[model samples]
Target: MQDCRILITRPEPENTLSRERLHALGLASVPLPMLNIAPIKGPQEQAAIRAQIFDIDQFDYVIFVSKNAARLACDWLDACWPMLPVGVHWIGIGQGTTQTLLEEGVPALSNPGHTTEALLAWLKPAKMTNQKILIVRGAGGRPELGDKLAERGAKVSYLSLYERQKPIYTAQTFFMLPDVHLIWVTSGESLTNLTDYAEQHKPEWKCLPILTPSERVTLQAKEMGWVNARCAQGADDNSLIKATELHIGKQND
Candidate 1:
């Protein structure tokens, strides 16, 4: 484990936390920050967010797609509405999001399996007819959640709180590509960015072992020509660490 080097492709700030955790576990981590998260900075977007916050009580359920979404949305909520509206059940896509919600003073339920499909399954038992759901996420993300909720007779609205941009490559980013034994991909976009960089700069690095947060991302990595792509249990830093250690243990065995 000490000799193992894992490349973390999550966005910065978060990547720093992941690297620190890995370092604590005696494993080396190389942060390559494939994605750059920026706040949506247009007047129209700000107005839209304000309007959504104004009408927050109209939604029956509020779903946060990621911890970033939860943090941003809660920041807005804290500013606009001093007291959170009652009777609206808050849902988080995973445990990390749930933790964020809790930290933001919002009670939320999280997906036990830490996947969109799992969240959809959990919601299937609820009476969704005519229910209003507010999804807080980045500008562009999977439409599956909204589509599925709409299919179940729920009205879904999106509040795009942030924008995800592909990071411009730097010397530091490229320097870690050759020494990485495993690439920890948190999202499909991150996986794509990593492979695109590898294809252009270091073709041999494309086949490195990639540990993804979900099977969908694993398949994406495989389709992108990564030879060894595996799914971790969840998208949290701890899950990535556990998956990396397990993979390393298996390789050593």
Candidate 2:
């Protein structure tokens, strides 16, 4: 069967998961990556991470907001600290992040639901006060996680494990669009990057339907002029596939 052409807007190295999922749906995906993940520079960030390595025991909790954060933090932990310190509780924002922690031999506490809101609700009942939280994340994001934890009387310390950057577009990738039937956007950042690129090169590509991983992401796509954006009810492979099938099924009708 001739697979439906799909454009994946995630970054190159990290686009594998989405590519595999789209491939399983029998879609011919072109990895038109739009962002890259790189380490943040400067002595201040590195020095803080170095200090946090040994001060791990001081923190009452460690939270990983995303799988990438978990991976990057684990990389640093392996290099600096020989083993994950005990007595400090670990929390992941969602199932995927929790799985990453479990694989790394960390006993993590996380909500099965894949949302920051779910994670917060789960933690609220614990009533953990005066607990120091070490948050491993990227350059920055919504402050809700830390803010909520602080409201619960927790001291939150943020660590920048890596940085997400817009990918440099080339003529081969940028000008060769319009053939793709669908574009899958996993992050708002990726959507923004594609919208910017398309506007600069091929504005007509904005009419393509975008399948986003979350409602928050869907709104971003719409703001980018992909008015036909559809969101997965959940952020998982099953939900993504279901969302894609629904969208395609609608198109067929």
Candidate 3:
């Protein structure tokens, strides 16, 4: 456990939890949040979003892409509809998103792989012709889900609740990170931003072990010159921490 400091690139309160879990396992952690999440700005956009939320029951299905989307959707839906509509099918892309909905008193279904490809596979057999589907997520993300649903003849609508942006960094503070044996990142956007940072400021990180939540992100990291990138099962803290243990320990051995 000694000298096994992991640079956690997850955002906000989540990073705090990640650090706590790493410490519990006798591993050290350094928080370096790459994504800054904020509600979608502009009054017209807010009004339009509110109108959409008020009519949530009109959609045949609602798919949450991340925990942030789930939490925000729950809050909005709870305010308008005390009892969730029964006809709508709720889908979560990953276990974490599904768990968020469940904890919010709204049950959602998701496959084990926790990737968009996995969700699309499970959704392939469903009836989508002329159906209305709402995809809840941050401002900018992969259009694959919506595009696939459209290809199936489903009318898909995106309800973006927030925006994910890279944090403003004025300094090239590579030394601020601890002796990072492994880097834990959850999303492709975060991975891309962090990879850019490494290329510009911390070139050495390219050779160190890194864990990504999905194979797509792992591939992205590798393409960006991170030679030692590995994919974890899921983005949740426990899965990341467990994978971190193996990678960091294997390196030490």
Best by lDDT: 1
Runs in model 1 deviating more than 4 A are 170-178
lDDT of 2 by residue, 1-253 (tens): 1346777776645478867877766777778887788876678878887787768778988989778888877777888778778888888877667878889878888875667777787776456688889888888766888898888888888887788888887777666654787777777777788888888887877887778876777887787788788887555556666777777777778
- Candidates by TM-score, descending order: 1, 3, 2
TM-score for each predicted model, relative to the true structure: 0.95, 0.86, 0.94
- lDDT per residue, candidate 3, 164-226, as tens digits? 989977545675655677789999999889988887888898998889998898999889888
Question: What TM-score would you give candidate 3 relative to the actual structure?
Answer: 0.94
The TM-score that candidate 2 achieves is 0.86
Evaluated at residue 145, the lDDT of candidate 2 is 85
Ten-residue region with minimum lDDT total, candidate 2: 1-10
Assess candidate 1 and give its TM-score to the true structure: 0.95
Which runs in model 2 stand beyond 4 Å of their true positions?
A: 41-44, 234-236
Residue range with the least summed lDDT across 10 consecutive positions in model 1: 170-179
What C-alpha lDDT values do all the predictions have?
0.87, 0.77, 0.86
Query: How many clashes show up per model?
Result: 0, 0, 0
Q: How far does residue 34 in candidate 1 sit from its true spot (Å)?
A: 0.9
